[model samples]
Target: MANRCLICDKKKQVGVSSRHHRGVAGKQWMKRAQKTKRTFSPNLQWATVDGIRIRVCAKCLKLIKKEQPKGNLPEIASK
Candidate 1:
């Protein structure tokens, strides 16, 4: 698995480490918080959506709301 943020596409980074008493010591490897690749629904998992594998974001997963139809029609009124 690659070290990358699925949402923002942030990449892994390396930084220097230092101690309280001692000065800069050595380089330390760091990576962005990773999101689990797998999910409860395999069909929804993706890396790209432009006709390819794409990871679905939380906002996209939100349930779509249905709006009530305007102008009561006679056909619908009977029902």
Candidate 2:
């Protein structure tokens, strides 16, 4: 399965990772910490909406749950 949110099309994003304690205590290091390439993946999970399974991100899942009680899931899930 593709690692993407079906609702909003959220996917992994390219970013940089670095050590947080490199310049702590006002001590300047001779060489700065190198940044490494990384990917920030969205929080995705499988969900069943209107009898169909789909992958959705955490934020969209929250919205779906919120609207479920109002019987408006089909409208949002279809998007």
Candidate 3:
């Protein structure tokens, strides 16, 4: 399956991870701070919509569950 949400089209996002350390003198260690590239992937899961199984993000799944009335599933429009 694709790493994308069928409902909202949420996908992987690029970001940065920063690590900072303090010096022995209790001062800011600028050289010791490092930044690394990272990726933020969506929390995708399998869900059945209209009898079709597809992957959706957690956020969209929450909305879908919230909009559902009792045991009846609502029609979710895909993007």
Instruction: Please give, for residues 11-77, the per-residue lDDT of candidate 2 as tens digits.
Output: 9999999876556565667556878999999999888888788889999899988998898863543
Candidate 1 lDDT over residue span 1-79, tens digit each: 4443344443444444433332344532242333334323222334333233434334332211111143321111111
Per-candidate TM equals 0.26, 0.78, 0.74
Lowest summed lDDT window (length 10), candidate 2: 70-79
| Candidate topping lDDT | 2
Worst 10 residues of 3 by lDDT: 70-79
In model 2, the clashing pairs are: none
TM-score between model 3 and native: 0.74
Candidate 3 segments exceeding 4 Å error: 24-31, 70-79
Tens digits of per-residue lDDT, candidate 3, 1-79, equal: 6799877778999999997666656555645778899999999988866678878899888877776656555455554
- Return whichever of 2 and 3 wins on TM-score: 2
Backbone clashes for every candidate come to 7, 0, 0
For each candidate, what is the lDDT?
0.33, 0.82, 0.77
- List ranges where model 2 is wrong by over 4 Å: 21-29, 74-79
